[model samples]
Target: MHGRIKGEAAFRRYVARASDELRQANYTVSAVDLIVTPTRTVEEVILSTDGPKGRVDLPIAIVTDRGPGGLVEIRMYFSTWPITGEHAIRPPLLQHDPNVHEKGAVGDYQRALAAGDLAATLAAFEPQATVREPAGGEYTHTGTAELTELYTLFFSNGGGIPLEHCTVPDDGRACALEYNVTQWGRAAMPPEAGVAVYVRGASGKLIAARIYDDSNPPLHRPDPSFAGCVL
Candidate 1:
């Protein structure tokens, strides 16, 4: 129990013990199988168990990481209801990095916008970051400078902007934001409404962002509102 358990056999034994414990408690449970992924960082195991009053079917997925420190994360994905019926359960989003805070991510982006801090805003993103447009479109920024330019252009336009909500799913590596942008200024601003942004990254940085929106077509103007804006 002290040393590291290596290979499938060791893992099976561990699962067997856990299953037996449940059996003793009059719970119907079984150890299915262990899956070792190619990356070696993730090991997923499946468990099929039953609930009380013979009314529930519980299917659980347990994910583990084989690193310097062995760690396991268990999640229950499906469970049977007591009166309604059997249905799939929506698992709550869990963050992988404990250091990341949802408020920090949302606050940083908002602060950067208010201060027009291009460098700071871009700094929050990963080196290769992609931002998807509202109309099933996408744009990838190669460097921090380029990302800053995009941010600058976005705020300079006179538009009614609102950040509805931000959720950090799968522990800080990804975030989903619901927002709306309306109104527009000549030669620079674009009208928008009801936008959804999905951001994913690691190490407290943003790697990718997928945006979905239903709005008017894209407009490209020659003269931007912030003609002399910098930094």
Candidate 2:
């Protein structure tokens, strides 16, 4: 149920196994939005059926790349917290309404995040905005207070977080970015694969930023406790 699968037969078995497991668990999956480019497609989906405890909402993004022959690659981005309901207490990001797509707002957010400007970043969000850390629900940051704390720690390295954007697909409600983490502040690192979704609100501010990545931060100014924070 983890890592990459090779070969068409192995991939088929993997899909079958996943289908069987989801069906056995009584989970229902649905697509929230889809965006297709010339050579790639991104589908935002939600799995909010049944889990070990009860109904849990898990938002995911599936990215597919097209080759000359057919589909060349598929990557799914999500955390397993909703599936296991482990240390999760926050509400779902896509419970009632999906995020609205505002490219302007998304662009502002990207600038602020890339520059590591905490104030600018906060200004790009609504008053009650939330940021779900890549780790899981337990690390969700809501409101200005929590978000301030989170971003302050984030920019402690004295510079911005650099990303090598691969593909960005946007429907009307959300923009999913496929990226590779190349640097954090002044430190350079090996390319680490990751994906993040920026959800815009009616006011043209970001309501949520959901990250699905496992990149380790190279902290120049480390905090003793940030709840096992990562990119």
- Residue-pair clashes per prediction, in order, are 6, 1
All models: lDDT? Answer: 0.40, 0.69
- Give the C-alpha miss distance for residue 181 in model 1, angstroms: 2.6
Candidate 2, residue 48: lDDT: 67
Q: What are the runs in model 2 whose C-alpha is more than 4 Å off? A: 1-7, 19-41, 44-59, 66-72, 79-102, 220-231
As a TM-score, model 2 comes out at: 0.70
Residue 212 local lDDT, model 2: 70
Point to the candidate with the largest TM-score: 2
Tens-digit lDDT track for model 2 on 135-188? 444678899999998888787878878565656777656777776666687777
Give candidate 1's error at residue 20 in angstroms. Answer: 50
Task: Note the residue pairs that clash in candidate 2.
Answer: 101-173
lDDT of 1 by residue, 1-231 (tens): 112445678868978986786675456545533334422221112233344455333323333434455555322222222213322222223323334334555457645544546566777677777654322212334556677666656545443123323222333434443233322223322322232333546555666544433333223432322111111
